[model samples]
Target: MSFRQGAPWPIPPTATGKVQMKNGYHQVKYTWPAAGWRYEARWHERTPWARLITYPSWRLDRTRPGKGYGPDAAPRLTETWVGDHWLPVSRLRYAAARYNHGCATSTDIELLKAAHPAAKQKKLPGK
Candidate 1:
């Protein structure tokens, strides 16, 4: 931990946590590397996107799918969830445009179940 002489606050250490949320057909876990930093926003994962990867974490997952990648841009899943619906897994970039609008959360699934009638009852993982 580090603190500034004049400031009353201490700089918190980097912490990590995992978040798994599902809305529509999208389900994935995001790892947060720093403490006290939680992503707060709305989120949608569109179909037809590709896997996204975050380095240092070196984790890989599918949200959509990407065609190619370079050194500077770490590989990331193509996102597709959007506006209370699940599209067929073929729309490129899925709903990449909307991701900047919000982050996803566990409660969104509750909202989705309230809106859509056919959502599969999810079983607890590892049960």
Candidate 2:
């Protein structure tokens, strides 16, 4: 767990714990990294958007199946959760556009669930 006392508007997923925003508010966040899925949750002093977020393997990687490329060239899952919606984000540009929009990646859903109980119910859109 990390702390950003006076960070900018968009906080990086890597920074966890209590984040001090410019608006004089604190956002509590937790992230989990996994091999097949990633889960994250963030909440603030005031009402916030969907506090629960999740990502699947396909959305995590940009490399089209059979197309092996450098790590930087590969498409990565969006770390930020900008809106209230869950997953099934199809637009490549949409996912790429949001910077610092997600939390840490987690390989263990069970561990993630411990932090954010709601995570269990917020499954991958179609699954």
Candidate 3:
């Protein structure tokens, strides 16, 4: 899709950016240079908001057993947008995973899968 300069992108409050493609249905361009993270969320108008971005991110719940940290804790699973697929990026506790690039709920994962059926499934390092 072509980019339409100055057009507003449909970015959730958690994200920040404007659309860079005019021919695209719905695209959200996000970039955090200092954080070394850049990704895009594209969805059709009929799709739900949660499924807009076909990416799986670490469930953002701080109340989890270990909050995704410490030893013997739950795995830290985040999403990576690879072309038309969203692949899971898992980091075991004590594995030094970044939380900012993660989701906060399982519902988001389900929704993302619905949007991108070809998404890659990944398990924790040893789980």
Candidate 4:
């Protein structure tokens, strides 16, 4: 999905932000000086059962100077909503993929399929 240039929330004075609304969530990103880059996906709407079991937001913060460095050099902090609390994530990409797939509505899947009819449907992690 293509991202728009701004976010719904107030961006910090020093940070630049962008947002993409897809599947039932708002995928937001912010880049600043020392903090590096931050990514988050917040649910826009949820079903009754989903509200009971899943957290409304998930985040990934990639520290500056650590982007090209190995995992040990930079801290790639990630958090996932698990019911009542945020759970720390060790596997960053996997956690983000899981959030994307889990938050995708049936309509979103159908739209993707329609747009890429010839492409193979790859199952997302934890799907």
Computed on alpha carbons, the lDDT of every model, listed in order, comes to 0.29, 0.34, 0.34, 0.38
- Candidate 2 local lDDT, residue 10: 35
Instruction: Output the TM-score of candidate 4.
Output: 0.31
| Per-residue lDDT of candidate 3, residues 39-61 (tens digit) | 34432222233433434222211
Instruction: Give the Cα error of residue 114 in candidate 4, in Å.
Output: 37
| TM-score versus the correct structure, for each prediction | 0.17, 0.29, 0.23, 0.31
lDDT of 4 by residue, 13-69 (tens): 656655556565444455554445354433222223442224333232333333547
Clashes by residue pair, model 3: 2-22, 56-79, 60-103, 60-104
Ten-residue stretch with the least lDDT total in model 1: 53-62
lDDT tens digits, residues 27-86, model 2? 445444544445444544432333333321111111122324766454444433223233
* Global lDDT of model 2: 0.34
Best by lDDT: 4
Which stretches in model 1 have alpha-carbon errors above 4 Å?
1-69, 84-106, 114-127
Give all candidate RMSDs, comma-separated.
17.4, 14.6, 15.7, 13.7
Candidate whose TM-score is highest: 4
lDDT of 4: 0.38
Minimum summed lDDT over a 10-residue window in model 4 is located at 116-125
Model 4 / residue 92 / CA error / Å: 7.2
Deviation in Å, model 3, residue 92 alpha carbon: 22
